[model samples]
Target: MHYRLEHADLSLILALVRGRSLARAAGLLKVDVSTVFRSVRRLEAALGRQLFEKSRAGYLPTSLAQSLAEQAERAEQALEAACVSLEQGGEVISGTVRLTCTASVLHVLLLPALARFMPAYPALTLELSTSNDFANLNRRDADIALRLTDSPPEHLVGRCLGTVSYRVCASPAYLSTAALGDLERLAWIAPDDFLPDHPSVSWRRQRFPGVVPNYRCNSMLSVAELARAGLGIAVLPDFMSGEQQGLQSLADVPPSYDTALWLLTRPDCRALRSVVTLFDELARAIRLGHAGGIPA
Candidate 1:
């Protein structure tokens, strides 16, 4: 008996291996659970072998299936690389570059650079994903990422754009009679668990361990808005706070908190012309303080 495997079958196998469950694989494939089950059964019947075993934990791949999945992954990567090469070799650089970053970065840094980059490269299309969560570059979840970190992953290749400075700020109305020494006495807008290790949170904890925030939010933009409304003092990235009309940095509070901003990409993705162009533009913009006037 002769059996042939199709690209779709290989893709299904790869997705199932990665996802480890029919439901999850279906989600990845954007297909129904029943379809995934049917397809897997068909493949097994054709091959006269069970590729995966259903366990209490999830779908566990057999040794043979694992090998096949690895081959499928290699195929997928090679196909993607070919596509990227073709797009890069074209006269006009054109392709979707998926970029991920924290919401604050999107608002204060990437957006401004993107505004300039888009007009310059009209053929390039960008897909932006903003979240506080780190995007999985190894999994190709994002081709490029803007990150604020002291220790970047060694697996990725990128340039350190600049250092981001942080300061405590409040609306002029809220700070009218407030003294810098009495920061603990005033209400505070604090980041939630989403940013547990954020410099602002650490600074607040170290300076006023006993004080509890009057307001808590996960988003940096929300904290800024709260401070702007004269709600409370908030520790904000200088890039976000500097240009706001009503916000005033506490005179006595120095910009004590800082972190490195990095524009990172996967080694393989960096070879694409579009990725390289965007990466360079971002590094240049950040270094020049042109993106949201981010301080060098």
Candidate 2:
């Protein structure tokens, strides 16, 4: 505790909490595991406490680790604040922001927001990836992730931008042309990432009993299209739900439903220059329903 916690020390604590192997954590840092191990050993020696207890599963935290995590998180945040001061002479916030998310959210909500941000931070570069998997932030697959889940993995900092309502929707022409709406007659569009296990899907099933989706997809963008082309009714987020030109929200079915979109990053990463500035901008974009982020 005599020496201040460094960025590497903070990263080590978070990696261990995420339960990745020592080798995996080392690979993430592009260093050998022994070096990381030595760093931990050195830190422990400096603190005079056992930080981790080895188990078959992985290293589990001791009380000292828990304490260190809290202190380290604070230290990292303070360090990042110092970096913000350094940005004064740079004229622009310049750094690469790696973002991972679903395509629909990316296209519909995120892009619009970035449009505004990029102008202000001319030197900031945003590299976006769309995937269902929660991209590994600890390993730097992406610097930030926007996800439609309530809680994020431990050691990551999560902020709730807001929620997007879910509604069963279809094209108006399709609804008028087809003799559907009997609740038992229409086929549903199932997207892989936002699947049956998701609460939105559960809500749909509850609203319309005994109906199953015949068309399945892996992305919300696909499902939205399928519904727009009159394939079938699909349960979708409000941002995607309202934007489709001909779509009609099933007024009677379910109105009181919502899914939250969370902005997440490793706590230590949140303190990094690129991560904090981007997060602040991204958080603003999400709240404003900019950046193709679906409306809450």
Q: How much is the lDDT of residue 71 in candidate 1?
A: 87
- CA lDDT, every prediction? 0.80, 0.72
User: Model 2 over residues 1-296: C-alpha lDDT tens digits?
Assistant: 48776778877876665544678668766788898788878888987878888889777788878777767655655555456647665434555678898888898889888888777665556788987667557677888888887556666676777767777788876787776647458767867645556655677667666766788887788888999998878877888776444678874334455567888876667557777888877887677242232222
TM-score of 2: 0.62
Candidate 2 residue runs with Cα over 4 Å from true position = 1-90, 192-194, 243-245, 252-257, 288-296
Query: What's the count of clashing pairs in each model shown?
Result: 0, 11
Q: Candidate 1 residues 21-137, lDDT tens each?
A: 999999999999999999999999999989999999899999988998988876775566567657677456656688999887888778878787677665666888887655567
TM-scores of all predicted structures: 0.64, 0.62
- What value does the lDDT take at residue 194 in candidate 2? 53
Model 1 stretches astray by more than 4 angstroms: 1-90, 177-181, 243-245, 251-256, 288-296
